[model samples]
Target chain A: MYERFWRLRGDKTTIIIPGWQSMSYLSDTSNICWFLEAEFAKEVVRLHKVVGNAVTEGRHIVVGTGSSQLILAALYALSSPDAHEPISVVSAAPYYSSYPSMADYQKSGLYKWAGDAESFDKEGPYIELVTSPNNPDGFRRRSMVNRSQGLLIHDLAYYWPQYTPISSPSDHDLTLFTVSKSTGHAGMRIGWALVKDKEVAKKMTKFIELNTIGVSKDSQLRAAKVLKAVSDSCEQENSKNEESFFKYSYKLMAQRWKQLREVVEAGELFTLPQFSPAFCTFFGQEMDPQPAFMWLKCEGDIEDCESFLRGHKVLTRSGKHFGASPKYVRISMLDTDETFIQLIDRLLAIQERE
Target chain B: MYERFWRLRGDKTTIIIPGWQSMSYLSDTSNICWFLEAEFAKEVVRLHKVVGNAVTEGRHIVVGTGSSQLILAALYALSSPDAHEPISVVSAAPYYSSYPSMADYQKSGLYKWAGDAESFDKEGPYIELVTSPNNPDGFRRRSMVNRSQGLLIHDLAYYWPQYTPISSPSDHDLTLFTVSKSTGHAGMRIGWALVKDKEVAKKMTKFIELNTIGVSKDSQLRAAKVLKAVSDSCEQENSKNEESFFKYSYKLMAQRWKQLREVVEAGELFTLPQFSPAFCTFFGQEMDPQPAFMWLKCEGDIEDCESFLRGHKVLTRSGKHFGASPKYVRISMLDTDETFIQLIDRLLAIQERE
Candidate 1:
């Protein structure tokens, strides 16, 4: 797990915050995203440059509570406030499950959830969420709705070298990335958006300011330190004792995927999507996809995969939540070593029972 | 000024977080508010018990990004989902300026901002916000809409002894508090709400989960440490070497108010609110109100006080934002010593110019 890497680093990543430090709500009043700590912004830029995963030059970085909040902010910014009806917000089938409820929970007059971007019809103006290395199904994706009136919000939460090969630096107008998936720091609730347009970025910033009065400065500072440590590890690649963050995480992910694929092949009860080897610019080698979640399909006569797994005391997200068939389930591969091993053991037990 | 007290305490309040600690998003999965850290919740209960400003027993504690987020959470929880129309949200005139926008910015169908709780004569269910020791103008407030369908959310952001006298343990249905105004740790963006009803608390938690997934664990941990230090300071009453947090802050606020009042009286350019001394349970004595902000009204020919002050190189929030006249302005008394002195000097110069 990525935690092992940080544990080995010890006090190197520990941050000390004094009582009087960061006491004010404002970080940089001169900037559009005034609540974003300058140090955090600098580190975000540095990390992206080090990994070459996303384009950061000339982009306005807007920090949020997490990419979850950023998604909402993007919707708020892209939708016209004075529209006669709420703008239709859509994503391809098997999109992130939370999108529908998150967009429509408050019943905001500016936007409404319109399911499945591919089948979205009768829409005048729409916002399309394109989640590459998509959740529920770890396949890379692009915007499905092609229209002049369509605005795109790219969610690249799982585009890191460990999960997927970084083909090239993503050059999108608005891209969201979170420390939760990248650095395994979900508890910090830190995420940033790379925005190409100044007005859109300002509106996103305004949404955050209205939502939570900006993200937490404590989390921002800690995220900066954690990210700096990540970049530092990569920079010290010549030192045999130091392990590169991506290399270390990629190894762990690759091992887990190998074991999982073997179990599925032997069991013949479930099938997983096959991924072709791709050359990664960041890793400087060809690698198979080692996604953070397994898009598992129940083979043969299994009607509901999630319920079957639950009967075996294994928890998995139902594919129905992701607008997919009940025979499919999304199982997380990002849990602790103990949990991952237990999951594999449970799957083997089910196979034996069969 | 209380920063000096914390600074004097040296590294006693310093926290060292191991890299692998608190990585999971789930804090207490069994609890309704799954992301509320156990340590932080315990500290919150302990602090409330120590201060006696609000009741903590048998109350469900919900943590948030700040009282700002909690306000929205409370609104979401209180409003009926299938209502014929969006529920009207009202606060009395001179309410916190951010309330209207924060409530209605998304133009949510769940609720809409209806101005002035006192004059809310609409015949339907409504939510009233009562801010005790209210922002802009520090004064005790109660629910203005007297109806069976009226729900109330109490924002007690400035209820600490340093700002106002703690009259009694407030046992409201839902009460909001934040560490920002309480401990001057605005950067943490941490707040909590004490709710009497289990269903309401659960709904509030859901709102937060949909909004930001959860509050930041890093901020919650740091806030817990800061609050524990505060309660520790109070408990060490016998140690003359250690100044209690409330006593230190109360003295500083009291001193600032005295100096400002003296200047305003001598200058005869403005009028300030008069306060009746009240008994404080926490301080164990009667004390005059020393609010964090000054509500100053322009006298004589001054039609717009905020502009008048701005002309003198002083910045203050206009009373218009608080639903009051332009002849009034709200000045922060919580700025640094240098800024406070300069503000006083500027006011004195304006008086001399007259």
Candidate 2:
């Protein structure tokens, strides 16, 4: 949430972003000056092109903000005046917490949180954000009311083919992606918005410019370099496409999902929602988290959730963050094979003891 | 900027953003990612902590977007808002264009292009921004409005001793620095902010949340590594203090400035007024650019100053951008030593011919 990691002493959490230089959005000329390998340098350029275009279409992506959330706030700002014509932000129940945060951003109390747009009011500047393979619950997506009808900013952060296989290709009016989920490089604050409609994109870009002078050039170039490197890495890994990135991402999540399922089946109490057939859903909380993070909740007590796990060196998000009351916790199926296995083993040991 | 660089066949300007994997926010663990050798990463962090009170004073630094323009925007968002009375943004004219851009983000326009407190209505909730060795004029900062007096964000983007050495230390609430001028990695969007106020820091962090999630994990780590690499490179080259970055930066600017100065020194051919020691200003009637961009006024046979520059194989920003009439023109000081010098050489040659 805060730049907490900067202050904390060394922890086991793996920071996988540094190793991805040549694979991202760096320019070709970048190779000459950077320490990354030539191959990685080329990759940076390749990914950069793909990511940048997603936001800036013709001329410059006019609307600008540090992240997609600012525009979300602006959208709230633009629509808040019409209270009766209520603008609702509808997303899947187990959605990115930030969806509601946007509502808070505008201080628009009018826009109450209604889980996905399917259930919410269908009219107005309703923001329908679908994080492909939703966070906390890794569901690629679900059927939704048409996005063309209103304000739908698809947070495709985890939707990249790297993590989930896209089923029913969604050509929404707007789609958002950030480097954090795709590359495990959450520190770099760069996100791009892809939109078919020019006005929407223009508004978003303009918002950003007004809010935060056009995005940081250094970050943008770095993002561009990383994107190029990743794409190139995926391409070079296999001839046809980004087979490796897709394969690696899918395999990692799939394997972890299996492990989490096994834990749940083993008398471990946790509400596992129906995830999109394409991806995995980790948790279903009974309540909202004020400041607490979500983790897999069980009916019985697992002696210690935080401290004991810390002893095992296994960390999971505390569920208090998602909602008011808390019953279920959340876990991301985003670890390596050994790490996943280790997490499962730790969970099992605790479960048996409980 | 568009993320994709490869897909576009014609002009290769767009680049995609790589995920956090390409950033370097940490210094201890994995380091050394980019092709560019940078010592600025170390200095940036060191100065940020000393100035910001965010970290234990360390010798190393980190990098992000250059100029801290976006960083400033993010900080404004994160810092406390003057909800009672709209926040005020004050900066000297011909200051960094981002001041106004950032000020205009949301709520009330924060960064107004004003000269002093006098320009602003005498009121509260004002953020006085003072750019040291300011952007276009290269003047050392002289304002000392206390932080407790109100909100003050300083743009020490180029306050280093090399370019605009200070005789007496200047004071402010927050200071910003970037690697672009310090290192040659303008492409890497890395900048750091130093603030003494903790509460203000918290608010700035909040604002950052709305923007991009966080700084790039990859870029952060890479910056950590680059800090080491840069220190090594500069040490090898015997680079001294912050001046190492400045020597190169100043050398580049001085050379180009000399060439352009020589031309201006010679003629009734080109007229530049907006440019003090900071930026070079000119006038060519046939140019149109947005307000805040370099302005130009053309008195000679030039109708389209923009076209004339294009014809001369040098790109000059048309004056219309700053919302000024199209009769003016401006040339920024943002180019490599070779490129900028070449541009001046070309212009000087034209003057000689005339």
Worst 10 residues of 2 chain A by lDDT: A283-292
Deviation from native of the Cα of residue B294 in model 2, angstroms: 9.7
Return the top candidate by TM-score.
1
Relative to the unseen true structure, what is the C-alpha lDDT of residue A274 in candidate 1, on a scale of 0 to 100?
86
Best by lDDT: 1
DockQ of each: 0.73, 0.17
The pairs that clash in candidate 1 are: none
My TM-score estimates for the predictions, one after another, are 0.98, 0.65
Candidate 1: segments with Cα more than 4 A from true spot: none
Model 2, span B142-177: residue lDDT tens: 554444445666666655433443333333456666
> What is the lDDT for B110 in model 2?
28
Candidate 1 lDDT over A67-127, as tens digits, reads: 9999999999998888899999999989899999999999899999999988898648999
